[model samples]
Target: MQRIRLDAAAAANAEDAEVWRWFSGLLEERRVRWRYMFSRWVVNVDRVHVATEQNFYDAIRMAKEAATRRGLGLSTIGCSRIR
Candidate 1:
């Protein structure tokens, strides 16, 4: 029910700045925070990563890698920009 800033890394780089937008919400369990987001819709269901690393950089990297592994590539233009 609340929004929070969990990333403190500098956003000097364009990619770093873009990382913020891909993030949607936080899911917590056992006092731990996890990044949550909706993947590009595919088939009847979208494949999502619910337990990605909590750190922004790590989360982004993991997402990119996972997408690549699944044959769902994320392009430069696909990166989200912070509002």
Candidate 2:
């Protein structure tokens, strides 16, 4: 049982590391900014941004999707634009 738990933990850590790497690459490639504030994940791309519940991976994914949609000239329904 202990070994099983340890393996699970290791897997989770590996997944987290992978996510962090991807996020870092995204920052370099897209000039994106991110922060955790008010118990939420806030991601910004130029004038547009998104805030999501504190799930780190989901928040980043949503932000990326929003940025892509905006870049493609699609509506960003859940994102806000800085004025």
Candidate 3:
């Protein structure tokens, strides 16, 4: 499995004061690898999402499976559909 990374460092420079402050909450930097069941693909990422910390492994598996089963690409897991 290959590891992928999703860095949110761009949030550090967020124009909105509230957004920038919120980004500050991500004090830790990390990454995780997710295996795709139906393909040779994997997702590596890092962020401050609660679901990521609590059920990241499962979430990735579900996302990968969902994409593969539906014959879609990474973009298939849209930002609004991740939950």
Candidate 4:
């Protein structure tokens, strides 16, 4: 996955920064190379090797699930390929 759009409601929360920090940390712990852009509303994940698309999607799913488990309500609007 190259880009992910975060949920608007979650992005506007007062504790958004902390949530982002935790999310990014979780991604790192899972060995996913990603960074925030456009004021943290967008996440850019580094390119994955060919034929590893499932792994990338799994990482995203796990992160989203973890966030939801923590009551964060995190959601991705979309994910795009880098080309």
Candidate 5:
């Protein structure tokens, strides 16, 4: 995995900052660099764009956990569906 795009609707609320923080921590764990851009409509919604690698599955689990904790929607959150 060379990238991960977090779904904005997954955590669309002011109370979700903890989830964002956890997601940031996961990025650090994978040593993946990321850029975030706020999506239109809801200001609480944004994407966490990450750059990772093939062996990043270990971090994927943690990232998923963070996403889930942050109210990740059923929508795709993987790299393949990013673009």
Candidate 6:
């Protein structure tokens, strides 16, 4: 699995007020290893979202599994693949 990383301090200066990130590693059912760690600038809060998935469907599947194990659930799931 290849880990994709983005270093904020190394990024070039930009005038955009908001920065957004979008990621898609598999085009036809493959693995995507993702790692994320979030920290608040002025508050004591941390968040993380990471998973190694075989495809878009697998990502949703894994999330559902995790939720289910914790007695939680999801309302909906969506995809934008043109098949």
- Superposed on all Cα atoms, the candidates' RMSDs to the truth, in angstroms, are 13.8, 9.2, 14.9, 15.9, 17.0, 15.6
Q: lDDT of candidate 5 vs native?
A: 0.40
Write one digit per residue (lDDT tens) for candidate 6, span 1-83.
Answer: 12323444334323121111112212122222333224211101012233335554444445434444544332222656567
Span of 10 residues, lowest total lDDT, candidate 1: 24-33
Give the higher-lDDT candidate: 2 or 6: 2
CA lDDT scores, all candidates in order: 0.41, 0.67, 0.37, 0.43, 0.40, 0.31
lDDT for residue 39 in candidate 5, whole number 0-100: 26
Better of 4 and 5 by TM-score: 5
Candidate 4 vs candidate 6: the lDDT winner is 4
**Candidate 2: which pairs clash?**
none
* Better model by TM-score: candidate 3 vs candidate 6: 6
Q: Which ten contiguous residues of candidate 2 have the minimum total lDDT?
A: 70-79
How many residue pairs clash in each candidate at the backbone level? 0, 0, 1, 0, 0, 0
Q: Can you tell me which runs of candidate 3 are displaced by over 4 Å? A: 1-54, 74-83
For 1-83, candidate 2 gives per-residue lDDT tens digits of: 99999999999999777656556665656656777889888877664675475877788767666766677223344568799
**Each candidate's TM vs. the true structure?**
0.32, 0.50, 0.24, 0.25, 0.27, 0.26
Q: After superposition, how far is residue 42 of candidate 2 from its true place, in Å?
A: 0.6
Model 3 per-residue lDDT tens digits across residues 1-83: 12222234444334344332322332122233444444333444342222222353445544444444544333322256546
Off by over 4 Å in 4: 1-54, 73-83
Determine which window of 10 residues in candidate 6 has minimal summed lDDT: 39-48
The digit string of per-residue lDDT tens for model 5 on 1-83 reads 22323444444544356545555654444533432334211111125422232344323434455446666422433436535
Runs in model 6 with CA error above 4 Å?
A: 1-51, 74-83
